[model samples]
Target chain A: MYVESTGIQVIETIEELQKTLNRNERKDTTVGFVPTMGFLHEGHLSLVSHAKEQNDIVVMSIFVNPAQFGPGEDFESYPRDREKDLRLASEAGVDIVFIPSVEEMYPADGGIRILPGRQADELCGASRPGHFDGVLKVVLKLFNIVDPDRSYFGMKDAQQLAIIETFVRDFNLRTAIVRVPIVREEDGLAKSSRNVNLTAIERSEAPAIYQALQSGVEMFADGANPEAVERQVAEGIIANSSGKIDYVKILAYPELGPVTDDTEEIILACAVKFSSTRLIDNIIMSTKDGTPCSE
Target chain B: MYVESTGIQVIETIEELQKTLNRNERKDTTVGFVPTMGFLHEGHLSLVSHAKEQNDIVVMSIFVNPAQFGPGEDFESYPRDREKDLRLASEAGVDIVFIPSVEEMYPADGGIRILPGRQADELCGASRPGHFDGVLKVVLKLFNIVDPDRSYFGMKDAQQLAIIETFVRDFNLRTAIVRVPIVREEDGLAKSSRNVNLTAIERSEAPAIYQALQSGVEMFADGANPEAVERQVAEGIIANSSGKIDYVKILAYPELGPVTDDTEEIILACAVKFSSTRLIDNIIMSTKDGTPCSE
Candidate 1:
């Protein structure tokens, strides 16, 4: 049922969500879904906005998926603000907000799992083993529950978006994937829920992560090879910020394969650790013209 | 497109099947799906019959999934009488038949896969590792393509049935799984596509496999423990037939857990090998009433 004040229908169980969607289904409504982990930011809201424009109905799911987090990761300390999220979602024109609990999502040991292949062995997946498998598992379950006409994802977590796209294509999922470009702060820090965890000093240094990616993109535009682009991005991050470098990779887009002369599209991506917060950002570009593909 | 002679819509691609099902969707049609490897027998048609009774549309998929077949198994040698199968499918009142080639199903190395947990460790899965993982993967893909309201499976592959049911429940799949009782020969042998591979002597001996299972069911009815029921079934197969016993055991029905007094339902299941041909059979019964649960 919808809360009168918010005018956004809130569904907490899979059954209830399906029932509500089924009612909409009779009218030939096309649904667009945006799945998030509850601590909503501009990046997530951007996805909802895209969904609203393309779909007759927009659904936003707020589930802090435990399966995707590793042992030392901040699953416990992850930021959450339900009231603020609902307010922002309503303003963003989201029609339904599904807030399922942990127990509700994982009622028992699912004895079945979705495992990612080689695309998961580098970048965030390398640092966080079993992360994409968990991500795919939850996303598949969410997709089955929502059965949306289209699902929106941001390119800030570029590798995650690629792997999810791969899953949908390989599995013959009905929902089309809509790629939403990375939404950034005015200074170019990719907006993330984890940005709230940064100290004031760390906050000022975080925009350097995206700045370094832009440098790499510029290097490639100037005819620099992948190795030089990766090195320049790595060096730029080190010189500009106190954050430790995690990785600066320029790989074939979506496939995440080693870039070669034949590669048409590539991604210059990086991750940085600043005391408590770890940030990731990337630029997907056409290798031919060396222009940003999605911006 | 439908072949005029058969009057059954035969689709070979996922896209066309979805498009056809989409047309059915607008009419509030409920679909029932039956997925099988080709060479349809009475057992497969029985599934279609159950599906016909339940839904407005029936989609049967025949894919000899390479993933579910282990090395040295009967995959390459597996029977395929497509012309006969189409005749039977049309005769059985099937609305649509989906026959996808291996390349169509796996266009590329699907880096993503569905892995089964402890439930797959015993019975057929023990000897055939990575088997149910393939089964679940293909089934999930087909379920996605068909988007059926209900799907049908036979209890002859009782362990596979249990695993599929578990997967559907754990993943919150919209498709409801309907368990059709195993169709068997009048002589008590379970009907299977592989039954044709049996030698004359082996074919004669195959009935003993089901007889042994029925004996075990009687033992359980007489208050025998799981061990006694298992041993009795094993000895019966060895005494009555020359076939080598693969496995004979009684376990809790769907979870495949060890049988305990608290277990309400149990399956007395067995497998046998005669030269190259292998056979499996099972009887699911209520512990309290000692009667077959479905049949």
Candidate 2:
């Protein structure tokens, strides 16, 4: 499958991809899928690398999924540079890159969509009406298309990861979900394709988003009340980054519930806007002993 | 996996079943899954036979899914006979019978569920609320758990089959759905596990249900208006059986949309109740030239 030293299969049609994967499947090749919305960054490459390490072949998708975008969102303006993405994917040793068009992916005006259950409404889903649903639909479609042995996602988007975990568990998807640790820049900003959209001034200030989340985690560990931590985090983001805060909440980790004193693991999550650019960051807090708490 | 002459592997947990299947998966064995409720009859056996013919190994599940049953819709009274089912599955050459308890299948109370749009609102779904949602949930779960190359289903539950087909197609499930043609009693009543609930008198009158459907199809084929065909089907059922009609609707096949002039394939479906016994039957009609007309 990887005969080319620098060349990788660039599959555009779903039928061709399925046929190729079916051939590999008959030979009992284990597949790992990494779904991306184009404009590949180090974060995406890390996922691809993880996939290659774990499975026999890695299939990466780079369609700027239209379904996940809402009205007035960056669907049309989302970053795209296919040549750069292809270069990165080849360097990461990807087996295939599936690139489908808007028409090919979403032909029907209104087709099947996955409804995000209880977990979707709190963070990103609260602002973007049907964002999580769209994400679920596309990912589910990709999972079916690739039928991967394992699928990789970053812990950076904790809520999205949690939702996918639930989707796979509840639906009994045998494709095991492998959650990769979040990759961050030296300045501590979580790596994202959207980070490319940040202006020079905004890029420098965006690191404060992660910095604020870290402060909240530290406060919680220092025995501060959940409310106090929430307040400090919100004020820190507004003060340091000069970004409008969307939400700053202290909640139970992985389970995504309200924070109580006895809550073993907690997620300090928030979203902020800087000069019209929206960014999100979070950190998971657990007891110093690092015991497994809420999964 | 079979260790005895009548020794079909009986797995009680999803994890154990997955482990066994994973071993076979690594060996490149083609797995076919047949999901069912207990009290296995010839109809269920037929599905098993179909799976056996197409796959290297067959796995059948017998769990009377409670979620698919509406309140007061015979969930509690649903029949079960483990010993008998085991014997039947063994005789049918089933390789494995997964009999999971409700707790094992649905681990959490407030968990994820599917929201079936469009087609779910008609036919049997019209009479039973959340019926298709429950069916989709369980079937999706079973698909995930088995991760089979193919899943066999009887066309007897036409609406259920149609909905599952749509679910698999839309969700991008790779498990090919093999629709086994409807199995029926010699007297023409479609064989169902529910037939056990019928009293002697009701059982004697049940064949008329299928007979009335035949009359409706004959009338429609003879160029009766859609409304007239509906009337004839309803009247024929009431006259021939002592059962109260739940619904008698002639609709487009597969999509389950309302019947119209341009409808290409037709599904003449009905549900009737005698005392507490309910029975459903349907006939699919299409043009001889294979033009898309009614379904």
Candidate 3:
């Protein structure tokens, strides 16, 4: 595979990206964007793979995005391997790699900031204060800079993808947002760079996350109540030798709604802290009454 | 001037706009939008005029945007003149007039919405709860429907304009927002559809709104302190035979900040209650210290 390290040519600043995209816009070229936080995991590659298939030119952005991380969070220690990531991205058939510095993304005295509202008050936003606002702010900045025809996002960050979909719908974003299914490891551990932080033993037990979620789905499939399905999933996770349940509540996907008997989608979402590494996993399954059962 | 007496195509459904925009997207034509609450005054015409100058196609939407109005406020009695607005917009060169019903915009379920953050919380937002949110929600809907290359807004709604600018910048909206200067009556009353409600006496007093604002600007030119300038403007408005000062203050133009000695590009904004009619006016002025001054 020919690996091209775009040392200043591909995209360095917002101006450079805008120039490239604007030129394409005039010529009517279809541009696609895949935004990634950089560690080159299979999950991110899946999104890139989808973007490459859909558009004439694919632009992949690899930035850690500090704003998305909260106080005492793992922003500084977030996994990054530029040389390896570039090699993987280049191999994945990405047309351009947009590597922008923090300074480039956020200028000094930048007054512009995006604050997500009520919907932002739920899901991951509830735990990580200012997380979605940061996500939205940067995503918007990237979208404006890239001005792509279609943007690709992986379902691994399910809530993030949902929020972006809302952003696209609510704000009338011009770019079409294409969502790809979450890519997982052979054992069903959702592919994540955070998987790197797991110990060998912890990694073996990690598939239990998916297993618990599946159990909840199976219960819902077998005609159990949504609450019963949620309870079962929580039980399964807590029963795991290495898993400590953080939260395994059933909610409406994206909206983070409470379980309602009348409605059909109750997302079975779970967060578990394992070996000082926190992992979140969820499943959206239709229940007997038509609610989502996320085990 | 060509006049199209197009009947109000008042459809509140977002799905329809989405479908229309998607269809338009296939043709790849430049689209421009002017979002307005139904009462089309000269202020709105300036925006439509600017939009006409910039884009291949123009869309002017008329909705009273209830979110921008506070409870017990003018939501019920706010100006609604579809027939007149249509004639005015057509004369100003609007290509499409989107008149969505409230049920269409807010759906029966009223699920999904937009959030206009901190900047929106200040200024008019302080008096009007959820005003910017409503503005954002509708603007996003219109943007999606029109998929405009450029959109126009009048600066007479200064706070609204700033909030929209902040929203676009923070959200990474693809469309370029063009702000048109405020249009005024010969007597200097800021052109508003609401002006139609003024009685003969109220109409006569309306001009005082502008005169008071002008006095504030003149005071700044005379080396008056920011506090003294504000006092002069307040005194002028109250002293008017038919004017009742609602608010007379000096502040930074874009940020709506408190006036300091170093403020530049300041605004002297005033609102006066003339019997039952409320009139607002402002004058832009520069400070000696190169910072915005507020009156």
Full candidate order by lDDT, most accurate first: 1, 2, 3
Off by over 4 Å in 2: A1-5, A23-29, A107-111, A288-295, B1-5, B23-28, B288-295
Q: Write the per-residue lDDT of candidate 2 for residues B225-275, one digit (tens) a residue.
A: 767977888888888778988988877778888877677788888899878
Highest TM-score scorer: 1
Pairs with backbone N, CA or C atoms under 3 Å apart (clashes), candidate 1: none
Task: Compute the lDDT of residue A4 as modeled in candidate 2.
Answer: 40
DockQ of 1: 0.65
Estimate the overall C-alpha local distance difference test score of candidate 1: 0.88
Per-residue lDDT of candidate 3, residues B161-247 (tens digit): 777776666555667888787788898778987887788877876776778677667777777777787788778767764767666
What tens-digit string does per-residue lDDT give for candidate 3 at A22-52? 7424465688899988898888888888887
Write the candidate numbers in order of decreasing TM-score.
Answer: 1, 2, 3
Superposed model 3: Cα runs more than 4 Å off = A1-9, A23-29, A108-123, A288-295, B1-32, B108-122, B241-243, B260-262, B288-295
Please write out the lDDT profile of model 2 over residues A53-135, one tens digit for every residue.
Answer: 99899999989987788999888878899888888899999989888887766655324456877777788878888898888
DockQ of 2: 0.41
Q: Over the full model, what C-alpha lDDT does candidate 3 score relative to the true structure?
A: 0.72
Candidates in descending DockQ order: 1, 2, 3
lDDT of 3 at A234: 78
